[model samples]
Target: MKKLTVLFIAFIMGFSGALKADEGMWLLPLISKLNMNKMNDMGLKLSAEDIYSVNNSSLKDAVVIFGGGCTGELISDQGLLLTNHHCGYGNIQALSSVEHNYLKDGFWAKSLKEELPAEGLSVTFLKRMDDVTQKVLEGIDADTEAEERKKLIGENITAIKEEASKDNDYTVSVKSYFEGNQYFLIIYEKYNDVRFVGAPPSSIGKFGFDTDNWMWPRHTGDFSMFRVYADKDGKPAAYSEDNVPLKPKHHLPVSLKGVEQEDFAMTIGFPGSTSRYLTSWGIEERMNVVNNARIIPRGLKQDLWKEDMLASEKVNIQYASKFSRSSNYWKNSIGMNRGLEKLKVVDSKKEIEKEFTAWVSASPERKEMYSDVLSTLEKAYADRGKDLKAQSYLIECMLRGTEIIALGTRTLKLEKALEDEESDEKVKEVADGIAASLDAFYKDYSVSTDRKVFSAMLELYYKEIAKEYYPSFYNDVVIKKYKGDFNKYGEVVFNKSVFTDQKKLEAFLADPSLKLLRKDPVFIAAKSTIKLYKELYGKVAEARASEAENNRLFLKGLMKMKSDKVFYPDANFTMRLSYGKVGNYEPKDAVIYKHYTTLAGVMEKYEPGNYEFEVPERLIELYDTKDYGQYAATDGSLRVCFTTDNDITGGNSGSPVINANGELFGLAFDGNWEAMSGDIAFETQLQKCINVDIRYVLFIIDKYAGASNLINEMTLVK
Candidate 1:
């Protein structure tokens, strides 16, 4: 393969055409050459360099990868970070209990010292990016065997990543693009000392709960604040009392100016994944196999969790984040399947495949290069269907359905150290880590709750999947020992397993016995489940390889066949800029959804003592008095949330919505339900990015919380 020069990227991305609407998640390094002119024409006041300059502190410096998959931006020079409240749900829930339930009631730190350090929370900054296609695919021609090609490419990527991160502590990754036709090397700097600052209660932050998620005219105040702390030398460090708040290189100035219809708006975020170029067969498999797995098992598990949560506040706080995490994707799967069928996406893709097949047949060279592409993809998807379903079920039901399996898996590291006859100090290190984490794990765990979930999920797996795919223990222990009753097996396991009780786990850590752990019921069951998953995955590995290569080939051919069409690579969890305008959409006939929703809408949905729609008394009093302070629109109405056409998906949950100038106006949180299929297929007219108005965030911070010290930290732009 020849080098994909920077000039080539500019030519491909900078092309002028109207192939589609604003349907792109563009890489920033080439934005100046590709999108600056179009962005300026759409009312942008800042240059591409202002948005993404690696040499100087720019807007990219302010944007960080919050937690694992979400995007966050620095709001003040003190490294005060702003992200979606849902994105911070796990951390808040972890720190909550019946005594101080931050998820039920709100939380605010009056001063820096009062801010609580969030465990397992880290923020990552993109240091720089480079086009490294040539470096990654340096070896071989068309004659190279597929396995050899994969092995050589892996070796090449490892070498490039090692070389890039050799001199600095920055993490490096090489991401493929255009379906492996291009590659980019990204460098990131991570800071782990992130502290929880403030958040509204679920009543406000999660106003509508499950019903309002992925819906339009949203009134949720989905915003949260955190502060990044570093060592005295301004270097990233572990949490410590001596650490100080980081002085960010650049921070976004808050804008009180409200959004208007057709106003230019943009969002930069780390969108997780998209299958925009997926084949029809793949789509069918996704809907029937993969998503079906998520829908059925998760739906069952969430129901069990909700019952316990509603019965007791303790269980509610313990499983708050767990339930939210599970339900978010469960609902998304349902909506996506419905959207895909409604839109006839499979039929449309079939039409495209027909076109590609005819185009390939017209020329001998094209035929030789692409004749088997469709057939190969079709066969791979067909072959992997059963195994894929089994794999997905294994993950949702056996692996993630219950918490005990994950807990059991965590002990493997200590087991491995023990088995290898490593140094006593090494074994002690592993044991100590597990001991320290036991409190945190059991803090949110409930043996009864998990035992119920365990029985139901395993039953579902047994009933749904083929008998051949059952975990080895299920047939042996569940059938022979427990008369095929998963409930009986589950009850027995939880009753006897050391992992079920914190004190038992602590006792194990003290003794450090290998024989006992090997005999542990939970460990034995987890190992069996994991072993089945691995075996299934290995069975479909070849099909996966074929599918991937064919997908890449089909895309490469499609790009060349339609050279004049404007195309942007699918999102791969990288920092990308998507430019669009703030606007409303008509979800159906005779119903035009408005661009924004105000506080009155929240009040309209309010019900007395209702879990989902209950209004706080202080908020109601503030609404009655019309005391919105400095955060109200000129018409004396306080807007809660708004909508935009900016292209975004799951990992974009906490992205910052910026105006024409480089100032924050809203926080991007969810996508409207009408466009749930946007990830697989961009719904140009119906898709909308739902965001909480920045003013509402400020209003809650000032009047509701009265944290003036926190307010003073920001540079608000009037």
Candidate 2:
């Protein structure tokens, strides 16, 4: 702890003069020394220890990693957890049926017994974190080759993790910070018996859908509730009928005090990734190649799926999650490209690089280390550009775009097991695994829907990518035999392939044969595409590796050159804290935006039968009667959502937004559209985090849904 204290002091002394108040995703352990004073000035009443402490219960005890990618916070001692509705959308959809379409009508558990178990869902609590940098880089330095350096670091991380978890059930991992310049060991305890408690319907949860996904003045409820369960002994365990609600160490008291403009606000959660240190060449490649690849193909696929989904209610239920997932990113890519180009982010990076290069040339030692960093980046990106589009198409089309391909590839491992003549027991195990997976796989799968997707995406790939990069089967089969008629090709494959039908696949697996699998049309196409992708990937491996090393060195050099500028590491799905104020901004000239939206706005946007804007009958009744209960503001308006300047990204979805007294006031959900470029380069003026006002969450639960049982579970503060 003393060593960490020393490191914190050093970091603050280096950059304190230039650090902006609201710009960083800071490490929690350094808050007492580096940030407490400023936070106190901003109206924070709690000490740093109240927010984070390794040896006692604190705010960190309440925050949990939701599912695989989002964040959740415990709101009650009974382990009542709250997160964004979109974060729980997949589970809600999975549990839905045409008869009981929860996604459309919403759901609420009247009692603990009524809560439904979400299979395979889990929540994790971070126990503590320790700086392990010295141990991780013990024998590695400037002279070490990239390959060897990686190998040594991997070994060290494994050993450290093993040591940390020897006597506890904690899931431990060592993560690199600052591009491997620093490392920390994090420990987490995971609970697997999480259950779905309640959620508003998609109309409210996803009020704007794709249209208002990342926009401001949002009125979406955007929240869901779950409960964690533990074994009789109060320890982590798999699902069991005998399990009970967990008595957590800490849970946030919900605040009814609400928010005012410039009120102190903070968010704590796991952010997925950000490449803020990317050079100009990297930014160009991302904008042109990666973003374009995602936006174009996904949009095409979504259009076809949307038509099919709208035609039949059952089909809509089947494709709801898939369509939402695809369109979310498709819209994001489009927004990011627009933001980058409009904001001149590439020009900003170029100017930074120019300054860095100039600074490097002035010092011989720095020149030796960083002289080739920018050159390496430019050449690597240029080389990668040759095959980047081809690779994207392969992923979007063959691997992801076509459902039959994914289903077909699942049998490859069993085929390999048969080829190796594994034991009968092992063979049965593989067969059983495939059988279990098919139930969930085919539940939402539609042959006709996927057939259309395959045809459209395959044609797009064939027309857009070069022939030399095409998989062998494309040339030998589709182009050669079918005369490049992807429609006919899709028809034949869907009708003839065993992968399209669960019964057919099961029968084939019962009496498996390698020859049959190898001859299957879907499997053949998948194999060919994967094989070609591997070959192409091998070609760019060296250049990509060199680019990584050079980028790491460049970051190291830049930190020294700009010693007075605060530097936070790029996000890698790790927990971080960001603080700011609840403030509004002008996105463009003469356009002033407010800090919050109210229930009146939701009513204003309501269209009787429109999917994205439809309001539930009960919600309309409540609005018409002004029945907001205790959740309405001083002006007798129900606040729906608000904005904050806190830095956040993708995985921060569903994060808790706490006030100065460490009470839950809102849930962080989306970033404003004008600042989609925030991931690559922070836009101080335009970057704002949109949050669902916690009071709005309660209003819907108590008044609209009549779920007072949930209201009783939380500890509310005025």
Candidate 3:
């Protein structure tokens, strides 16, 4: 690959090499050039090519983009997969029901025949990657207009992606990097038939639940198992009885040898997003507008969901995934806000910006190139605050928070089809698609719980957001008729709307008519809300474009200004490797947290009737008997979870924590609460990757659950 361009180089000038091991989510393709020597210095035994090689079966082959968002690793020749229990929580909940409540209890498939099919779940392996920045910006220059630059880049990406997948069945994507100053092409091979093999129940898997979700000194056994299947010829295929377990190119050798403080620890996974390059204005917007919207509405909605879930097993099974998904980030937003404030992240960013400004003012050439970058970004963000806040509240309060509104939004396609006077066959195709989805949707839906969510979320939106951001229905109907009582309006809509009842919806779809659909109150609200959101999006688009272009220029110049220091690209759901040492941190004055937690800690937190801290009976029995088998540390304690300084974010969940010899010792599940602000600003001293000890995973499989079949298949190292 062509090296980065620069007008001049200061050549380190006493700069510390490569931003330390504890920071940076680095690209694999650049590891050898940028990070190999440093990694080797940190005690890594494997070569860079051993970890990521396009031509050979390397560690990359063992990793997959689990489902849509998290990471998973192959553990056995039979295609057995392992990831965080919370990462697989949604699929597990989808497979559960009141009759066979796997979420409350647990599931263990004794043989291949018994593994449950995870219908919507899929695993994707990265085939390779290529640098395509030169191609993407071939004809672009300083004189090019913003719109023209965007169009040319888009065309170049399309051509690059087309040529990359010209004669293959691979999924190829061209993603921008370094704030669109550079780009890369990623290729992936996706398999559709993934099956659930085993998992510990919530008591163990989600031991601390929300109370301890993003906290440290965690004792959760947060691991789950799945298996990928393919056709006899080893090609990706749909779920079928004839399909056999995949014989993967590589699989991780699980290590019962365990981990210790200061040992080499590394993770390779797809981290979702980070704003390490984001300006101070952006940080403020993230904290006040985006997080506030989520905190206020989601917390209110989740409380309602939790009440119903506690009252009935059916409701619990139905809403478990939804609640988990909502609460995970709701609590995250809370913690992130707290961290940002406590860490003074905004002031830190502003100081950097001030330094950048002074650097630019020194030279006329630099002044011309970077003069308006900061001002442009400041004005862009300042002007769009109201629109962004309105959009965030709109999304959290109605679009996502209310189940029935989300379900109702699905009918827009059918509505458009009928309005456009499409052919009967074409309309039937659209209607058939909606009808096919209903079974799965209604399977895990509870009308009573959804109605409560609808009422609470709608009331919050109406009272909190400005009138101008309100949907058409609130002014046209609610204000005029119900005196702006959101609960009454919600009740009327739920009572009369077919979207609230599956049978009624199916009947409406049986002989669907445009007139009847328009008459529905839920439909009106959904349509209006979506239309307003689009309008809000449009209002912010221009400012967003200005901000994006300026941000790109700012980064390009900043890289130039700090040419001696190595810079890693911010995360954007791409495979990245982060290495650090396994260690502990002192979060506060005179209080130090240890590097790891154990089964004894799990027992200490156990309360018989407490939902969040409840320990399963069988797990308690094993702990009392000290039946940890061979998974215990040298001191005879069963290590549950440990901490590392490896930089990670949301999507890094389920990443395998490999040791110096490249053997799996832990599974990265959560990041410690002290460094929740690390996504925006890496906290080297306080940031820690909370991981579930792989030995604990083995112990649970071999001793607690008696699923020795899984344990026997894995290649364990002592």
Model 3 earns a TM-score of 0.98
Model 2 Cα lDDT, one tens digit per residue, 599-702:
89988999887888998888899999998889989999999999999999989999999999999999999999899988898888889999999999999899
Q: Native-vs-model 2 lDDT?
A: 0.89
Per-candidate count of clashing residue pairs (backbone under 3 Å): 0, 0, 0
Residue 387 Cα positional deviation in candidate 1, in Å, after optimal superposition:
0.8
Rank by lDDT, descending?
Answer: 1, 3, 2
Model 3 poorest 10 in a row by lDDT? 5-14
lDDT for 614 in candidate 3 is 93
lDDT of 3 by residue, 1-718 (tens): 2234322112322333748888989888878776788889999999998999998888889999999999999999999999999999999998887788888898899899999999889999998988788788877877788899999999999999889988889999998888998788999999999999999999989999999999988999999999999999999999999999999999999998888989999999999999999999999999999899889998898999899989998888888898999999898888899999999999988998998999999999999889999999999999999999999988998888876777878889999999999999988888888888899889888888888888788788888888888899889988998998877887899899998888889888888899999999989989988999899999899899999999999988888787767677899999999999999899999999999999999989988888999998888889888887788899999999999999999899999999998899999999888888888988878999999999999988888888999998999888
175 in model 1: Cα distance from truth in Å? 1.2
Q: After superposition, how far is residue 514 of candidate 1 from its true place, in Å?
A: 4.8
Residue 77, model 1: lDDT of 86
Per-residue lDDT tens digits of candidate 1, residues 1-718?
Answer: 5534454465477464454436788889978877888889889999888999888988999999999989999999899999999999999998887899999898999999889999999999998999888877788555677788789889989999999988788989999998887889999999999999999999999999999999987999998999999999999999999999999989999998888888888898899999999999999998999999999999999999999999989999999999999999999999999999999999999999999999999999998888999999999999889999999999999789988998888888888888998898998899899999888888898888999999999899989999989888888789878988988888899888999999989988877888998889898888888788889989789899998888988988887677777778889999999889988799999999999999999999999878989889999999999999889998999999999889998898999999999899999999988889888999998999999999999999999999888789899999
Against the hidden true structure, what lDDT does model 1 obtain?
A: 0.90
